[model samples]
Target: MSNVVAAAENSYLAAFDQPGRATVEPTPRPGWRQAARDRFAELGFPTKRDEDWRFTNVGPVARTEYELAVAPAAVTLDQLEPWIYPEMARAVFVDGHFVAGLSDLDGLPDGVRVGSLAAALEGGDVTAHDHLGRYAPFDRQAFIALNTALFADGAFVAVPAKTVVERPIQLLFVAGPGERRMAFPRNLIVAGEAAQVTLVESYVGLGTESLTCPVTELAADPAAVVDHYRLQQERTDATHIALQHYHCERAANVSTHSLSFGGGLVRNDVWAVLDGEGVECTLNGLYLTRGRQHVDNHMWVEHVKPNCNSYELYKGILEEQSRAVFNGLIHVHPEAQKTDAKQTNRNLLLSSDAGVHTNPQLVIHADDVRCTHGSTVGQLDADAVFYLRSRGIGEEAAKSLLIYAFARDIVDRIRLESVRTDLEEFLFSRLPKGEIVRQAV
Candidate 1:
């Protein structure tokens, strides 16, 4: 038998009693923080026995010792220059705490509130108080429970009824230089009835090898339109665990794009519910991994109302010895007649040792629903590569051209021009003979 050593400093339960948590002063039966802590204590870390996590093991996260990141690190605008978009109103968080000086939110419209969650809580923002932890459930999720129990700060945004936000807002979480520090960021986006908004969340840490766990909750009111994008670009030595929950009301249109480019081990858990009739929900994601990186995307979509439509598409490109997993499920309730849902997951393996595990599932309780699921895992077409090579193109450039073509469909579907351009540039940089790929595109 292999010997295992457990350290008290790394114990989550021991750290819960520490004096510097977000909810240090609290009381009541099953208070928000206490309740989450209790649940997490019961659940602990999931093992391979758990069906949802059987393919991806989180033992590294459970064993690593991390100090709670409650203070903001000194980060200058120059350091954020790479990720910052001058045209977008942005909120910056360093080591889980908001840094007002590094953010820019000028010329925001009336009835729109975007800032740090801690400030909103201290200043008594009614909307923030009413809906902070309303959507992300912590009872059954260990990461969500741990984040809720120990989270100190995050990003909060609220758009009022009938308003159109002309400027896109960005919430950037930066994990600064540290020795295995951990940060939990909780974000909430609330769009009122008939409102329209575009929002982006970015997690970027250039060289920091920290652990970041974030939970984001979004609610789209009746007839509202919400366009959301999430970008994860942490260092290759870091670990990231994230969860997002979205509620789509009657006639609301909600679209979310998840772009993951970096991190050593990453887990993305996403769930969306059609809460009312005539709702439209779309989920799209792209992930690229090299080296020994491992990435997993788990999605659960529920249709609770009739006449609602949901679409899911996720694609991954694995190189070297990298690995990836995609688990998508569409659950249709008995009353969800006329529900339409389609799920697809595709993977491209650039190396013989690269691997992928994809499971697209459908659980239907209604006979009138239309649901379909499909997955594909394969290597590049040899004849296509040969044809490109025969056309006087170098082997690497020819391969890059084909790779670019494979990913073009998803990137072209993005409506946000600036984000699309940046992602295109990013994709180009990752390809071999990337300039040839860009010119060919």
Candidate 2:
């Protein structure tokens, strides 16, 4: 066994009373982490024995060597001249620890708190802690337990009742240069009754061989609306594993948009639960990979109450010898009658060497539920490409145009226009360097 796995099992067993593993410091948890860690040790990493992970492999993730990252180098705003966003409240974290001086949180409204998890906990913001690990049962998932055991820093936002935050809270997580460096970021967003907010979490890297394991949990109370977007663009040799868990209450509306473009090996796991009546949710994702890179996105949407609606659509583009995987599951419980849920996944392969595996599953224990799922994987339409070429378009230009049109369908579904434009620009710039990105969309 690798040292990291050995340390994970033995270190926690040794310090059962102290709570949590050692990271930047000994920030004790409120008793939940200890129980969860013990369970993780007994269960170990999930294998094909676990139905949920039957098709996915954790052997590589389990044996990888990862260490907690240290304090980043002194990179100030003046030195960060290339990073800029439009009129957004921003917070910066380096090596998984909040750097207040490096952050720009100006123009934020009153009654809204945007800070780090460590700082918030030290300041006695205990109300938000109640729902931290409540959504997903960490006892069954090793990664969740590992994150709870080693989490050091991440963005924390809490909106009060009946308040609307006009500006979006932008979070940037930077992984500094170091060998075997690992960072764990935990983000918690809670929107109170009738509250409205938007949150964006962006992950980037300064080094090539780093590991970033992140977990984000969002909670929306009754009649609340929340828009969450996660953008991952890391170094080529880095490995990223991220999980986003969201819970919605009665009449709550939640929209999640994900863009995965970088990293040597990246996997994004999103789970959203609608527990209250009349709750509505929309989950959209886009992934682009080339070379030998590997990208996977797994999503689960559960409806536990009646009269709820949900929609899911994920698009992917793979090139070279890269591989992509998409697994989507929608479940409707017996009490969740009148549930309307639709799910679909589409993939475009630019080269014969590229590979894509997509599957959409539905489990319904309710009779009156309206649920459907479908998946498609194929190359560019030759008819469309020929038509474009006949209309005076060059061969390369025609192929690119057809490919871009396939991806544009999902891009147009993005509610934020600026984010959509930025994503398009980033993809466009990368396409010239890769066979897949060069495609029109």
Candidate 3:
């Protein structure tokens, strides 16, 4: 093993061995924690030698000596106002600890629970313990194992059967002012049978060079409908690693959207398993990178039952010397006959120095399954730019207009008005002369 990976493993194992660390929370299954630590120690940190992490190297993260952040820094609502959505029920966490003063969960519907995971575990909420580490298996992935063993606080949401939540629930995680400090945030969301809910996970940093590792588990029971959004807007010097595991039952519908705009090094891993017949799943993502930043998105969908449907679309806008990676896989089991799956990945490069790697795979064991996958990497269409320039638009404005038009294909799918508006504003600001296109729209 390399020195960097060895150092990282030792640091985490030392922290895990600290007295009182394992008993910090009254989790029903304490053995899971010890097992996670052992798994992490066995696997160590992933490197370029690993097949899944071949394109992206995490040596910088592994080499760094980081301490766990335990205390909430001095921050106020005014500083976080820019990222807050007024229409959603917000739950705030600072430095891996839930802060009640900054959260607003008023007027929630009956039988709906939205709050902190730490509180639920301490208050003896059996539901939290029952579903916390059930879906996200940590034995194979080192980062997931580290998060499962170290995470102290995160969001916990549950929607009872047959209830429809009018407002969305937002879980906002803010990294405070600290260099070389790390925070582990874990979330568990359960949607009962026939329940409907929209949940958002947003990560923001206070201009600090920190590390944020988060894991979220989502369970959608029979006939349930879930819309999940993950937004990452951290400091350019920060490193963000996250994992999301989803399980869909019979006839359940689940859609996830990932939007990433910031972070020095970012990796997002999403896995979904359709365990019952007639399940529907959709995954959508958009990533914009500039400077020397690196972003990666890895997704896997397993069709374990027959008559299931899945769709995936991901797009990237790269500029300067930035880089991005997209890896998607679709697997159909022998029993999963008549499965329909499709995957597409598209990337647009604004600079010749920018780079992107896209891989889409389909593995089918049933002859009746229909699965297709493709990827494309290209630059802006010169003909479209020339056409716009002939119509009295400047060269820069015309290029920006064409780029924005290409991105709108995914933005138009956002159902929430506030989220769409915020995303549009943010995307426009990233272009050279995007104000012209914004005004035209």
TM-score: which candidate is best?
3
Alpha carbon deviation, residue 60, candidate 1 (Å): 1.2
Off by over 4 Å in 2: 1-29, 48-50, 54-56, 70-73, 78-84, 432-441
Worst lDDT run of 10 residues, candidate 1, spans 1-10
Off by over 4 Å in 3: 1-4, 18-28
Better of 1 and 2 by lDDT: 1
The residue-by-residue lDDT of candidate 3 on 1-441, one tens digit each, is 656467677877777766545244436567887888889888899988898898888878777878776666777999899889978999999877788899999878998989889888888887787888888889979999998888878889999999999899889999987677788888889999999999888999984778999999999999999999989988889999889999999999999889999898999999999999999999999999999999999999999999999999999999999999999999999999999999989999999999999999888899998899999999999998999889899999999988898789789988877888889999788878978888999
Per-residue alpha-carbon lDDT of candidate 2 for residues 1-441, written as tens digits (9 for 90 to 100): 345456545543443333444333223345666666666776777666676666556666566555565455455675343444556788888777888887778877787888887777666676455666677667757777767766777888888888999888788887776665777787888898999998878888776577787888899999999998888778767788778998999999999888888787787889889999999999988888899888888898999999999999899998898888898999898999999999989999998999887878899999998998999999988898788779887777667666667777767877777778777776666554334444422
> How does residue 321 of candidate 3 score in lDDT?
98
Candidate 2 minimal-lDDT segment of 10 residues: 19-28
All candidates in order of TM-score, best leading:
3, 1, 2
| Backbone clashes, candidate 1 | 0
lDDT of 2: 0.78
lDDT of 1 by residue, 32-110 (tens): 8888888887777777878999988888888887878668778899988998878999999998888999999997899
